[model samples]
Target: MWQQKTIHLAEKPRGFHLITEEVLAQLPEIKNIKIGLVHLLLQHTSAGLTLNENADPTVREDFLQYINRLAPEDLNYLKHTYEGDDDMPAHLKSSLLGVELMLPITQGQLNLGVWQGIYLGEYRNFGGVRQLIVTIQS
Candidate 1:
């Protein structure tokens, strides 16, 4: 059986530029770690995932600003009135941004590109807990 851990995403009205290595470290030990696949999924609809440049904080900031400009909080949006203007934009951001990712694991670790990292893109105003399902297979 594979191992699992639930990551509690911090309240990020401003979005999260986080590293996922900590979560991966929690997987069960396996031998002959020749080939494995890691699957990640965000439990919230308003949140998403992106595999992007990890070396430069500027890259993360640039990407985040770009997305917000692409999908700004619309006061004119109706659905937002209920959850606030950020509501619809959150869904749009999540949609335009996306969710779920499959990573290739090699040598008992993830084979990510140089300067690449996994981030939980939270588009909501109030963030409390987000669930991440991690599966390690041999």
Candidate 2:
């Protein structure tokens, strides 16, 4: 069986947010899959997706810190400054992270580790509603 759906996440500030529950809330059909894979693709260039530590909020802050250092907003080398100073850096962060994630589905639920969860790498200051194309194969 194969199914696909698009989920629009609420707008968020520039940071990493744990959104595993939010995604699952929109995908009630996941319970029908006894064994399968869930593929998620973020339809945005200024944002990203990742799976990481969800128990501690500091992990997210650390991610933001390291990534900002990796792609500082004040770099004079950036040319894509039409949007704002944060736009180019946001793009860099998006590329540095990623836009897609694939996870195993077992017994009608996501087979994530005890400390693992989905993360929304909101790179833009006002990224608006993020879109995620979810595809499931059972």
Candidate 3:
């Protein structure tokens, strides 16, 4: 079996946000798959996807803080500044973090760890609504 869908996520501030529930809520078809794979692709260059801690909000905050330090907007060498200070940095962060994820499905549910969850790395300050293409194969 195979299924695919595009889900639109509302605009969010620059931070790492837990979106596992949001993604699953939009894809109830996973309930029918006993064993499969779920592939998620975030369709944007200035944003990214990852898997990380889901229980603590501080983990998300720390991720934002650390990534900002790694790709600061104040770098004078960046030439892509037309979009805003956060734009180029957002692109860098997106590349470093990546834009896709593939997770296993077991017994009709995602086989994520107890502390693991899908994260949307909203690197831009005003990235607007993000689109995620979800593909499931069983």
Candidate 4:
């Protein structure tokens, strides 16, 4: 079986936010799948998607700090500043982190690890609502 949907995620500020529950809430059909895979693609260049520690908020904070260091906005050589100072840096961070995720679904639920969770890498301060193309194969 195959299923697909475009989910509109809520707007968020710049940070790593846990979105496991939010995604699940939108896809109740996952409960019908006995065993499958779900692929999520973020339809944006300025933001990204990743899976990481869900139990600790500090991990998300650390991720923000690390990525900020890796793609600092203070560089004066950026050519894509038409959007803003964070535009080029946001793209860099999105590329580094990626914009898609594929995870296992078992027994009608996402088979994530005990400490794992879906993260939306909101690189822009006012990225507005994000879009995710969710595909499920059972």
Candidate 5:
């Protein structure tokens, strides 16, 4: 049997953070086990996942700004009440955005584009721990 561990993204993200490949790398395998699918789920309500540019920092900044503009924080929608104004907007942002993403795995790694990088989008004002579920299969 082959098994891997979950990597926790511990931060309230504003941009893309390049995680080392060693974290997701599986151990030595005696037999062949092809990964058919990858499931990445964001545990928090205000956070989501997106595969975006990994090469340029400015691109990520621009992306973040763009998403924020798409669903600006200060919109006056009183559907979901919360402690702070950003809370409801955050959920709304997630709704406008998404929660989970599916990526195909090839060569024992995530088959992301050249500039694409996996990001855990956090709309919160401060840092918090976000758990990602990575399930690999044949």
Candidate 6:
């Protein structure tokens, strides 16, 4: 079986946000698949998707801080400056972090580690609503 859907995520500020529950909430059909794979694609160039620590909020904060250092918006070499200061840096950060994720599904639930959860890396200061294309295959 194969299924696909596009879901809109609420706007978020520049930071790393835990969105595992949000994604699951939008896909109740996932419970019907005992074994499968869920593929998530963030349909934007200024944001990213990843799996990481869910037990602590500080981990998300640290992620935002570290990522900003890796792709600071103050770089004078950026040519894509028409959007804004955060625009070019957002693209750089998105490329480094990526915009897709694939996770295993088992026993009618996501087979993520105990401390693992899906994260949305909101690279832009005002990224607004984000769109995600979720595909499930079993």
Among these predictions, the greatest lDDT belongs to: 4
Model 6: residues >4 Å from true position, as ranges? none
Q: Write the per-residue lDDT of candidate 1 for residues 1-138, one digit (tens) a residue.
A: 455555555455557566566555555453346687777777877888889888877887787788889888855645554676777777888888778888887887778888789887877777556777766666
Give the alpha carbon lDDT tens digit for every residue of 1-138 in model 5.
324446676565554455425225432331244555666666678767666777877876776787778767667766565556567767766776677777766665666788777666677776377776655555
**lDDT score of residue 84 within candidate 4:** 91
Clashes of each: 0, 0, 0, 0, 0, 0
Better of 3 and 6 by lDDT: 6
Tell me the lDDT of model 5 at 50. 69
- Estimated TM-score for each candidate: 0.84, 0.99, 0.98, 0.99, 0.76, 0.98
Q: Which residue pairs in model 5 clash with each other? A: none
Q: Model 2: per-residue lDDT, tens digit, 1-138?
A: 899999999999999999999999999998988899999999999999999998999999999999999999998999998999999999999999999999999999999999999999998889999999999999
Q: What is the lDDT of residue 126 in candidate 6?
A: 89
Q: Which tens-of-lDDT digit does each residue in 1-138 have in candidate 4?
A: 888999999999999999999999999999989999999999999999999999999999999999999999999988998889999999999999999999999999999989999999999978999999999999
Model 4: per-residue Cα lDDT at residue 8: 92
Cα lDDT for residue 76, candidate 3: 97
The lDDT per prediction is 0.73, 0.95, 0.93, 0.96, 0.62, 0.95
Over the stretch 68-119, how does candidate 6's per-residue lDDT look in tens digits?
Answer: 9999989999899888999999999999999999999998899999999999
- Which parts of model 5 are misplaced by more than 4 Å? 1-6, 13-35, 79-81
Ranking by lDDT: 4, 2, 6, 3, 1, 5
Instruction: Output the lDDT of residue 121, model 1.
Output: 81
User: How well is each residue in 1-138 modelled by candidate 3, as lDDT tens digits?
Assistant: 788889998788879999998888898998988999999999999999999999999999999999999999999999998899998999999999999999999998999999999999999889999999989999
The window of 10 residues in a row where model 3 has the poorest summed lDDT is 8-17
